[model samples]
Target: MIDLRSDTVTRPTEAMLESMREATFGDDSRDGDATVQKLEALAAERTGKETGAFMPSGTMANLVAMLAHANRGGEVLLEDGSHTLNAELGGIAGVAGLFYRGIHGKRGAMDPDALREAIRPVTRYHMGTALVWMENTHNRSGGAVLPLAHMQAVYGLAREKGVPVHLDGARIFNAAISLGCAASEISQYSDSVCFCVSKGLSAPVGSVLCGGAAFIERARAYRRMVGGNMRQAGPLAAAGIVALETMVDRLVEDHQTAKRLAEGLTRTDASLCDPKDVETNLVRVDVRKSGRRAAQWSADLKSKGVLVAPADLYALRFVTHRHISAPDVDAAVGAFAELWKKS
Candidate 1:
């Protein structure tokens, strides 16, 4: 089956699996696992951060960052469609006791002016804002790359206000590849950053959170509080190490395959949004004019061995990943064309 559902669906490569099997396990809570330490150091060096910590999932990494940055009752500024706001089960409010000030953004990229206006003043009788959160290659926004200049502007504004910025960079490597820039360029604009190795990188599990040593120390404590500390996490970290070392540069191939898919979809139906909007590994199709519900369309595609995700009642999404090659994309496109014709 051609699985265009999500990047997170990718399985680990044979090499990654072998690395995991050969990893030397040690106690993470006591002596600290060597593989985990090596992975953290490599991730920190790549992102140009002072320190890094490994978490089991992107959600935990994001939660750790949010908990470390904001105090109880403090507010955090975020895009309305951001993963931290919409996808993390409201952990910021439920666990951290922080309020969210959601500002709507175009294509999941917030305007600097909108972000500035979202910040609450200390005199506002509320807990006041403490942090600003940004997501790159935003999941809900068709994997849009948040422009570096815009991020710099927002970070500058937050720094002026003495508010820290935490970046939810789950697919940030995709953004960096798309922009032809180093990932560290984006890291420079954030006080803290979290990214997933399990996504496009095709690792079995793990995410990395990076920042200054003090902030990471606090985040580690929060991670433990949330019962996220694993005793022998080296096996997972070994896969993450391989992902960081080997899987990043190949993202350009995924982006190219996504463009091919987008082109095919647009040729099948021009009523959908322009294919130019598909800049990374995700393609969002507006199926409103097709006179078919998204769930029904998805089910139909699944029956034909071409899996995809329903974005809404009238929209759907396709995410190209490492497991999907150029030929697989062509086949999926053919499936989409046939389905559109039948519809």
Candidate 2:
């Protein structure tokens, strides 16, 4: 199947599988796992953090980061389109007992003045803002990359108010590729960052949350509290290590392929998505103009051996990853073209 549903659908490479098989293992929850330890250390260094911890999913990573950063009754500042806000199933409020102030950003970037205004003053009646969260390569924005300067401005504004900043950087590498910079440079703007190795990197599992030593220690405890205390996680770590080492640079190819896909969609009269709007691996198609609901179109595409996902009632999303080649992009466009012609 040509699975454009999400980058999460990417499979592990043969080398990753081999490393997983040969990985040295040890009890993680009890004693420690050397491979997982190495993975955490490497992840921290890459993101320019003092330490790191492993999690089963990016949601848990973000949750733990928030749990560590904010008090139960405090608040978190969130971008309106953040995955943690709209997609994380309310773990911030439900699990962590924290409320969020949503600041709608322009192209997934919050205005600095808006951020300053949203921060509640210290008072008896109001919940004080404790953590500020940001998402880079925002999913809901069709994977738009947050510019480094934009992030720095937010960071500066947050610092003035003494609020800690956490980045839900699940697709940080994609943003890094787009910006032509190291992921660490993007990570430097926040106090904590969580990144997935499973998505575009094509690892089988795992995400890493990196931060200062104290923050990571608290996050590690939070992970254990949430049943993320692991055992013999070396196999997962092995693949993650390979993903970090071998798979980062090739994301340029995925970006190019996504552009190709967008161009193809623009050529087809039925599509409402502008090819110019596509910046990275994700392309959002507005299908309402085509007289079909986004979900219906997604299902129809899936039936025709090309998978996609709905972004909203009017829009569907296509994400390119290592598993999706340039040829696959053309095939997917062809499927859409055929379906549109019939309609």
Candidate 3:
């Protein structure tokens, strides 16, 4: 199947698998794992941060970041559709004992004024706001790329209020490529950032959380508390290292393929969002006019040997990844055209 469901469906490349096979193992609990240490250092340097802690998933990374940055009963300001708030199973509230104040953002880019408004004044009667969270290439919003200026403005607001900012940069590389900038540029505005290696980077598994040394030291303890500690984790870290070193630059190709898919989908009778908004690898299409629910459309597409996702009642999503080549994109487009004509 031409799985356009999500970038997380990608598998490791042969080189990554070989690196994993050749990786040496050591005790991660004792901080004696050479491969894990190297991966952490590389991730930290890439993001211009003081240190990094590798975790099993992006959820764990975000949870650890929240736990490290905010005390129990503290509140966090976040975009309403942010992964940390909507997709991480409410880890902030459930595991970290933090409250969330959500503000709606346009096209996944939170307004600085809105964020400032969301922050609560320090009072003896209220739980104090502790952190501001944001996501780049926001998943629920069709992978919209959050503008760097917007992030900087939010960061400025947070700095003035003495509140920390944490970025759920799960697809920051995709945003960087779309914006024609370095990932570190995005990271500069965030006090802490978490990025996934298993998504567009094509690693089998892993995410890295980067921040100041003291913050990361605190996060390490949270990592263990969350059951993210791994012994002999070098094999996974090896794939992550290769993903960081080699896979980032290729995200532009995925963006291009998504653009192609969006263009083709729009040519059909199905109502779709702007193809120009297809800035990254995700294309969210409105299919209500096609007289099919998103779930039915997904099933139809799957039967035709193509795979996508039903994001909502009126929308379906197509996500391009490293495994989906240009030809696969063309085939997906053709399948959509055929299905639309028949429907």
Candidate 4:
């Protein structure tokens, strides 16, 4: 079956598996693993940060970053649709005791002007702002890439008030490819950044959180507290290294495939999806107009040997990755057309 459900469905490549098999191993919890250390340093340098720590998942990486940057009861400013606000199981508020002000922004990015106003002062009545959060190639916005200028504007405002900025950069590499810039160019505005190797990068597992040296040290402590510290994790890091080395440049192909799929959807039924909304590797189809719930459409399509995810009651999300070729995209589009006709 062609699984467009998510990029997380991608299996590791032969090269990635080979690296994992041949990787040098040591205890990572005690910082004795040479391979994990190398992956962290490379991730740090790639994102223009002083240091980085590898974590089991993007959620843990984000949680550690929040714990390190903000105190209990502090506030964080972020977009309403961000992964921190919508996903991550409310760890920022529940686990970290940090209140987040979710600002409504177009295409899943917080507005700079809104950010300036939302930052709280040292008022006894309100929890003051400790962090500003940004998401690039935002997931909830159909993979819309936040422009560097927009990030710079928000970062400038946060810096003026001495507030630290954290980026939920799970898809930052995709954003870089979309915007024709390096991921570091997008990450430079934030004090801390996290990106997943398991997502579009197609590594079997792992995410890296990067920031200042002291901040990374603190995050590592939180990582241990959250039960995220792992020993002998070099095999995973070895695949991550292979992903970074070989997978990134091919992301543009995934983007092109997604665009092709979106265009095909318009051919099936323009109201099923708007090709204009296709950005990066995510194509969010609006199922509301078809008088069918997103889950129903997802199930119907899956029976046709094409799998997709129901992001909400009204929207279905399809993601292109290393496993999904151009032919798979066309077949998925054809399945959608068949489903719509039966409706």
Candidate achieving higher TM-score, 2 or 4? 4
Candidate 3 — which residues are off by over 4 angstroms? none
TM-score: the better of candidates 1 and 4? 4
Winner by lDDT between candidate 3 and candidate 1: 3
Q: Write one digit per residue (lDDT tens) for candidate 3, span 137-248.
A: 8998999999888988988889988999999999989999999998899999999999999999999899999999999999999999999999899999999999999999
* TM-score attained by model 2: 0.97
Candidates in order, TM-scores: namely 0.97, 0.97, 0.97, 0.98
- The residue-by-residue lDDT of candidate 4 on 1-343, one tens digit each, is 9999899988899999999999878998874799999999999989999989999999999999999999999999999999888889999989999988899898877776777889977687987999999999899999998888899999989999989999999989999999998889999999999999999888999999999999999999999999998899999999999988889999999999999999999897788677777779999888887899999998899899999999889899999998999999999989899888888
lDDT assessment of candidate 4: 0.91
Error of 4 at 310 (Å): 0.4
**How much does candidate 4 score in TM-score?**
0.98
The full ranking of all candidates by lDDT, starting with the best, is: 4, 3, 2, 1
Tens-digit per-residue lDDT, 30-138, candidate 2: 7889999999999999999998999999999999999999998898988888888888899999999998889978879987778889987558998789998899989
Candidate 2 local lDDT, residue 104? 72
Off by over 4 Å in 2: none
Best by lDDT: 4
**lDDT (0 to 1) per candidate:** 0.90, 0.90, 0.91, 0.91
Pairs that collide, model 1? none
